[model samples]
Target: MTENDKPAEAHEQDGTQLARENWERYQYCVSRGHRDYTRLASRLEGFYLGGGEQWSREDLEILHEQGRPAYEFNEVMPAINAAVGYQIHNRMDIAFRPRGGDATKELAEVRTKVAKQIADNCRLHWKETEVFGDGMIQQRGFFDVRMGYDDAVLGELSISVLDPLDVMPDPDAKSYDPKDWADVTVSKWLTLDEIEGQYGKDARLRAEGARALGDEDFGEGDDDGTSRNKFGWQDTGRYDAEYAGGGPRRLRVIDRQKRVLSQMQVAIFPGGDVRQLAGDEKPEVLEQLRANGAFITRRMMKRVRWIVSTCDALLHDTWSPYDRFTVVPFFPYFRRGKTRGMVDNAVGPQEALNKAVSQYVHIINTTANSGWAVEQDSLTNMTTEQLEEFGASTGLVVEYATGKRPPQKIQPNQVPAGVDRIIDRAAGTLKEVTVPDAMRGTQGPETSGIAIQSKQFAAQQGLAVPLDNLARTRAMVADWIDYAITKYYDSERVFRITKTDPLSGKEVEEELTINQWVPESGGYLNDMTSGEYDVVVTEQPMQVTFENGQFQQAMEMRGAGVRVPDSVVIRHSNLTDKHEIIQQMEAASATPPDPLAEAEAVLAQARARLAEAQAERARAEAVNKSIEGMFSSAQTATLVAQNPAIATAADGMWKSAGGIDKDAAPAIPSIDAPAVAPPEQNTNPLTPANPSVGMNAGIEGGQP
Candidate 1:
């Protein structure tokens, strides 16, 4: 058939229409983003980099005409950098935890190691810092994660930070997360060779043809002024010499990911997830499933699909392997479906500060010295320039016209009373609206150490939103890496994991292999694909200053008898060779003891035993003495009480010795005396004696 006689296929037409629609959609998104975010983000980034023009164009032009310097002291940069450095120094670590049965615990550990390995291999920290800086300066940041291949044999997960300008999400979407947006488009300029290498020769040819077409709608080879203005491009002659000036054409490649819900015929495996089936394969798969008595069903499900296209051609179209888009976004201050950033808060005050400073300098420059007030053309001996230049020189003579009054010296006006105060106020406001002095590591006005620490802590707390957003982004990225591992590392693969050994204070490298099927267990050991996992992000401060503080605190605790181990204290130190030091300490401990020291130790033990024996003997002696004292007191009491009995036995001897001292003795009562009971007497000792008791009984009348 002739070249024009062949009919266009329906599939080609559909692809072309889809490509056009996608291009249109991308254009609309770009337009909206430029209006809503990109322009402002560009300005904010300028502020961060110290390039944001504080004065208006007209004002700047007037200042330039007047030979006045438009000064800009970048307060925004210091605040933003302080915040970014805070995150970098106090880095966050990603950890994986088993969310399924206990069987998944080991696998989750392996996943954690693998995740860390991925982050290390990809330099995720640096990228994270860039993303964080962008988010703080602008309103959002993005992380793109995907699997890359090494030597086309081994797969590795890669993470990179995406420039906010390169990413365009659905502006009308009611969420700030890119994954939750209805669609997200990432654009980049690629050379033809790069295009061929990535998308294939057909794509390169199509892109080349589109560039040759030079259609503005195709977004290729067309340098609309928007790119230059939005990105603040200078006259670099790149477009004149390279792009449309006969050099190689660079095409803008768009990767658009969209979420869609569709109805599909799916085969439901026994106790498994449903798998979608194509129209042509549905009947055969159904028959096979029916033969096996498997379940079948139809359902509507949401799926993410990626479409790669240029302006005029579709390069690739496939369903995303991940559950969500690969690009994750972090918006620090999202409210009402929009975003605000630290720079936004500081811009007003920063501009004011700059203006105040600039005006102060300008006033000083203009009024630092006295000027001469003279009539027009009053100088006679010298020109105005020469006269003014030599006026400040010593021993210079000034000659004015004889008719004109001699030039009068006009003193400059004093600077306004509150000019310094205005500058200080503006500067303070800038700091207050953004990072505080405490956050910048500056000493505050508080005299108490505790007050200073509390102020610093409060300042850090002020950044909780951004820091928490960063942690959330990290957790999300961890999940992405985990999913990627499960999808890509489904074969026996060996990788090394490095970790700090807590006991030895050294980094230990371990080589692990996963996904090896075992017939005995009927499953793969360390299988990442088998179970669900949860991601947790924890802060691990990497700054030496923080480590030093921790070390000092640990030492103080140890001094206070807190029982903190020496090895742990050393681990908190910032010494680069602390592990070596620990090793040396351990070696010293393990060495054989000195003979003399051993002998001394033995003698010390013997002395302790002897002291204990002596203590025991002393206690026994004390108990015996106590018993003897009690017996002696009892014996004395018995001897004293027996005096009455002894006196009764010696009655005859006493009578002979005293000659019966009967005259001095009182009359005794006889046995024949009246048996009358003695009258009741008062028992109280203090009462008067009852002298009538014995006389009334009449017992004293008869003596024995």
Candidate 2:
């Protein structure tokens, strides 16, 4: 046969064989991975619901299990919840370590912008991963990352998380990063409408699907869990024909060529064909699809999809230009333990503690709430119904009976005293193992705030395990995202993100375009021209240290009576709008104090009073002088009246007074003065006898 013809024949054979083998592998993986896991699922479900799965008929069959309330006294939920108790979610920071050396100023800016874009994407997808991580802790052993195009984003690139339960791996894989793998598939339940919305009416396989679907020729799917396991993921759907009708989801199998995912194919369950069909295609086109990952459906079987078009070429499978798939599993030791037949390998002592607490809680509650049967004297109680009614009612009522003896009451046996201690210890241990006490805000109000903060810091340090794992997982996804951005973002595009302003150290919006990062700017592409670069991953910067440390410093400064800038204090606080706050503080400080006019007014009042007092004394002295003059004038007038010359003499005296004549003293009755005793010899410094040589000499002689 001709070379082209030989490939066509080989293609048909590959299609049939691949379908059978894949269906078998799917069944095997279910048996090994997810089927036996119903028990684990039950435990995880109970942990969240606060008790084991509701008591079933199977549970009721055993006399010991009846009347148990699934009262889920939960300690597991708290531990799992606290494990990721971060005030901030996006704690990761990315820096590109260029091979040659440091980058230029412009190049550094570009790299920083690039890091922020990736970080923004991580932040967008991170919350979901945390949720999945909780599940991974509870039941699912691990979670995964899927990087793809997001139309909602400006850059069109985004990241996503995958539940571990949604994925099925090759049954015989030895390691996480195996040298080779046959295949891995991810499945999800979707409604008919969603399928129609995504794949559309055009997705109908045409006449070929009608001819091939449920055809006896292709062979049946492996329905058994042993020979060929077919348990596909957590079904999530009620399999109801009505609401939430997305049952039996089409699983997407990522088939590999050598090591990388070269194509994508859909799986078909063992059921009648419900797929719409299209017009026939040439045998040559059909043959070409068989060689690739394409398949036709059969009842309880797998299928290779082919397109019927004018051009003799395969479609869809090759549309994904990303030669490598973006899905990467985060199971740290998935490959290692699975080989050793360890299911739920990630379950540690913490899980055991969690289960023990759950069991003990059930026992205690059941003992008190349900197991305890009330009893009374059969004659006094009379009817069983009446006794039940009395037991159920919360209100207390009593009926006095004179004839019969008072009814006797009997209570059920009490649980051991040690049960409370055991329960308390288990809860404490769970907190210790998964989440620390400090992280949960369980530290009492009486605890010192600083001491509590220290405990929190220590607890954060202890959480290094999961945090580190998170960093590592996110870093891997980031590497792929970086690669995708480099390859797919050929055209210049702007990605706007909120970034921390370098100088201000505050968040501000920024935009980075493709040209800003690639060859145009001296960034990854520019650096690559010189030498390759490495992706260095770091957990999101711990602002706790910056925040709490600054806060403590501020508080101490306040205690020390130091003048701390209001803006500086606010920076360490929970307040927002630092720039606005700083501006307000600056304005307040810039404003001058109100002038001290009141003090000036008081001083002015005292000066005015002194001036008024001086004026009053002057007026009184003038009045006294007037009175003296008037008295002298009256005496002169009386004498002048007796002698005609008196009036003339007064005028003369006024004239003489200017010339040297003085007015005679107006006399009153004079009394004889007692002679002063001779002054005793005095030692007054001012009146020293020998003035020149004594203490008062300097005053008299200037210097003796």
Candidate 3:
């Protein structure tokens, strides 16, 4: 029990000797002569101090004593025998410890337990044999049992339980037994080489190669068809035969990192098909069914179903949560069934929608092989004007009806010859022409002409004509027959005049006599002359007939019964040459002058005189104003005098005003007149008037 005293059990057998050597080696490797031996030595002491146990020197000594028996047995036996009963099992590929507390014994125990677990859990239906040493002992072994636990092949088995004897030891010589063993069954076991081989299959996991068994053995084949064997296995028959036949085998290692499972689930239900549940209901019902989920409340089943289905189909390909949910219905839900739900409300009417869709389709077809078609309902509920506008956008012509008969068409060549006359008659009498500019020339050119003429005639006659009068008269008289035909017969009644005679050429002269019955209100002619004739009574009777053709006549029948006979007779006495008198009378007759021509000539002469007088008066006024302004500004006067023409004109004016004498006329200041210098007698006879001095004074005293 002393620190330096070797355990008596250490020399008991080869197993005990081996255990002692291993313990010494472990202690030596960990200590390295360090002072912190307490912390380092704790693990080899075989009990966790803080987890579930406290340290006691006596208990430690007992544990050492108890381990001695298994140690002695281990020292006496070969190392391979310890693995005889072991099997690999479980998902972690670990094994159980031996029944004894000996370190070597425990190692063998772990191997044996692992092998047994593997044989118990795996579906192993094959056997293999290996002979040893001079054919002395031959053994055929069947491993990896055909039976499996919970449908899983046992890959590895691990034991974690500690023996009570490992914590405490007996003083007497005794065999040790482990109380309990923690067992773990692995679904797979992989050596570093196997893991590495898997990594070669998929280079993405190359970093995990160290944990694979097959990867350690993978290399170029040798001449014997055997490669390097870097990994050791306890059981491996569970894999398929193809996988087992290769010199070096590989097992697929799924990436643990990539095997992520989402904890949340999203289900889509078709609109109103979703079941309504109260707060007390279980959510599991909705979670399980395909028809019980939706983010929106459904009022209409079919529409909601379509929307949800669309969303589901879209989300099936994308992995984002954002794409999985539908915020609003795919088709807009307008409360009042009005097509109003658009991304931008500014796109106002459904007609605009139709236009937009049409344009979009056109663009798509032009740019690509898209077979888009425009639907009429896209312009639902649009007015006539809106429809026309929409049609115009796509270069389509539109026809709108006013819900009445279409307008009549008029022809160009079929216009009546007498349409002008008809229009004249109708417009003059009826006054019913109100055609607009577009209708005027289109209805009938001759008809329009007749209308204009009729209007003119009515104005000349000084009569107020009713609108329908001329139309009625024209229709009754069959006037404008061709125009009527054109107006009534053509599809598009647009009339054009092909040829026409000048209106002036169509004029006719006709004399019309109008009798005026005046009731005491006398009438006077505007422009007329009176003529008087002198008759002489002779021996031969002369007779004359008078008529009221050119003058007003009055007949008086008095109480004396005086009668002015219709025919008057006068008798002439001496013989006279009647032919000579008739010739004289014929020679005396004269044609009257054209009064209009005379008036026009007189007006022209008056205009010419007035124009000449205006020009003369303008010149006189301009000259007078210039003269008056000249006295106001000395500069102006000086400027005028400097020019020869202006100076001459001024001189003429001064003379015309009877010369600028101080006594005879008011003083008119002259801008260019030299300043009056004091009289200086000429000292030198050659210096006449001292012109240089005067010129110098003029230059210096010049007005600005």
Q: Of the candidates shown, which would achieve the greatest TM-score relative to the real structure?
A: 1
Q: How close is candidate 3 to the true structure, as a TM-score?
A: 0.11
Q: Rank the candidates by lDDT, best first.
A: 1, 2, 3
TM-score of each: 0.79, 0.58, 0.11
Candidate lDDT values, in order: 0.72, 0.47, 0.27
Q: Compose the digit string of candidate 3's lDDT tens values, residues 180-278.
A: 111101112243365444334333233232233233323223111222223534233334334676443443221110011233333334432232222
Clashes of each: 0, 21, 80
Worst 10 residues of 2 by lDDT: 306-315
lDDT of 3: 0.27
Cα lDDT tens digits, model 1, 1-704, are 66356575755565677778888887787666544576677678777877645556787899899888788988888888888888888766777777643326677778878778778989988988889888898898999888777544757887888877677778788775565689888877766787888878977776766633233223322332123233433434354224576655566777899988977566575547555554344353355455444566778876788888777777777776665788888888888567778899888887877878888898797674467777788989888777666665667788898788887767888888787888899889888888899877678454565566566677988799888888878878877887777656666888877778979987888898887778999656787655556788888864765676788899899889899987888788877788998999899899998999999999999999999999999999999778765654453333334333333434454466663455544211113223343345344434423232322122321112
RMSD of each: 11.0, 19.2, 58.9
lDDT of 3 at 520: 73
Off by over 4 Å in 1: 1-11, 51-59, 101-103, 150-154, 211-233, 239-247, 263-298, 374-385, 388-406, 418-421, 444-451, 541-549, 611-704
Worst 10 residues of 3 by lDDT: 306-315
